[model samples]
Target: MRAMVYRGPYKIRVEEKDIPRIEHPNDAIVRVTLAAICGSDLHLYHGLMPDTRVGMSFGHEFIGVVDQVGASVQNVQPGDRVMVPFNIFCGSCWYCARGLYSNCHNVNPNATAVGGIYGYSHTCGGYDGGQAEYVRVPFADVGPALIPDWMSEEDAVLLTDAAPTGYFGAQLGDIAQGDTVVVFGAGPVGLVAAQSSWLMGAGRVIVIDHLEYRLEKARTFANAETYNFTEYDDIVVALKRQTDFLGADVAIDAVGAEADGNLLQHVTSAKLKLQGGSPVALNWAIDSVRKGATISVIGAYGPIFSAVKFGDAMNKGLTLRMNQCPVKRQWPRLFEHVHNGYLKPSELVTHRVPLEHIAEGYHVFSAKLDGCIKPLVVPTAA
Candidate 1:
């Protein structure tokens, strides 16, 4: 088998590796058929995530065909097509029983906050991800679901992470019928959040980004107002003016640790590693929303302190709701949305790279070249 081996920051290559076998009774071996390189994977590529060891594969959003299953695995069989959620968990744990699979207590030694995630670093459980020819899926019954017969492979792969997380962000906003929603990022997740906000009955949606290309994508894809933050002196103030000086009814921070805006914050956090992540986007969300409104955070962040405006949030009585999305929990409804043609997740797929050249794929995405929004990985096994 071949996999994307992480050597260090900005260093990855396709290397031959041992094919993972079923190690637990509930485990299954999946021959990856379709997979995606998520934006969160860039944090690992840039050496931001703690304890991401070399030689580990980095990918979490994937759909595959089952190759083998452990004795206790019953939900899927050999040759069955399945989409594996990013969250790895046991079905019967306290969190899983409560539909909080992302917080399952039985999966990770570092299970204090996030549960086991495929291909994230040791901080989230050192499970290898699916950016390869094959991947080992633990607790197969709980996290792996059969791809609906009519769903496209691209949609199924997106549902594994980007779509669900974006939908979850909107779900957390608790948007009222006539509310205004603003998303601070125009990446796939942010675009999806903006698109999903309309489904929740938002009266207006606005997406913010520094890139003209992404803002353009948001305008066309989400059919929402777009703001290029670089053109404005103070984006938050500009946002307030658009909202009649009160502020948006809800704000979503889809840009996490790697957010750019404040020079010092990006320098200290992303460059120097002095802070967990840059809080520029999260802070913007706090300042750009109405005093008593809600803020939803679906951005990927390190498990450390950030320079967020906690004081302002408390003072304004804002409702701060965020988590590593319980990906599977959003599937049932998401499946219907895709089936009904409300969204075409495949429209977000702007590039496709083979496993042999994934290093180039990472470079193109990280550099934001070629108007790249989302890049899918085509493993040899596919």
Candidate 2:
């Protein structure tokens, strides 16, 4: 079997490996048909995510056909085509019972805060990923949802991650009927957030990003309006002009802290400095949100914490709710949306490179070149 193996920091290679077999009663061995690279995978490539073992495979977003299943795995059969959730989880647990599949207790025994995620770092779970000819799916009965016959593998791939994450952001932000929603960032997740706001009945959705191509994609494919953050000196002013002097009802920060920051001088005055949150988009979101509004943060955050100007939020009585998407909870409904054509999550998939060309795919996507969005790595199954 051939697999995309992580060699080291910013290094990946297509190499031969053994076909995976079912290791647990709840496990399934699937012949991967289509798999897409995600922004999270970039973290591993950049060596930002620790504990990634050498020779580990590197894909999570996928839809594949089940080749074999353990006796206890009953939700799907050997011939079923399924969309595997990014998180490896057991369906029954304290967190799972509460619909928090990202924090499943029964999967990652070493996880003190949150459970393991597929193809993520060893800090999450060292489970092998889907960027290969075959993949071992743990908790397969609970984690892999049967892909409907109507959904194509290309289109259904992202239901494993992006679409549901975007919808979760909108839901957590409390987007409601007739509410104006602002989504910061026009990456796959940001674009999805904009679409989600529309689906959830927002009166208007404004997507913000520096990339013209992505913003255009947001409008043409995701069906939402957009703003280029680099063009606007003050995003708050631009958003206010569109909102008739009031702010949006819901504001979502989909880009996270790395995209927005400022340098600070130390009080000691020894030429020391620190970099932390400036809340560039969050500040605009706070200013662009209506009084007593909410902010949903779906962006990935690093280990460090940063500061945000809470005075405005305090005065406005804004509520803040943030989360990584619980894909298990969102999968069933998102599947329906994908099956019904209400959501075309695959529009964000702009690149489909062969497994041998993964290095090129990484370079192109990492540099955001040639209107590249989410690139799908199409590996040949063994």
Which structure among the candidates has the greatest TM-score?
1
Clash totals in order: 0, 0
Pairs with steric clashes in candidate 1? none
TM-score to true structure, per model: 0.99, 0.90
Q: How far in Å is the alpha carbon of 81 misplaced in model 1?
A: 0.5
Candidate 2 accuracy as TM-score: 0.90
lDDT of 2 by residue, 289-373 (tens): 8889999988765333345668988999999898778887887788778777788887788889988888889889877898998
Positional deviation of residue 75's Cα in model 2 after best superposition, in angstroms: 2.5
lDDT of 1 by residue, 1-382 (tens): 9999999999999999999978899999999998999999999999999999999999999999999999998889999999999999898999899999999999899647889999999998999999999999999887899998999999999999999999999999999898999999999999999999999999999999998999999988899999998999999999999999999999999999999999999988888878889999999989889999999999988987888999999998999999989998899999999898877788999999999999999999999999999999999879
- The best candidate by lDDT is 1
Clashing pairs for predicted structure model 2, backbone only:
none
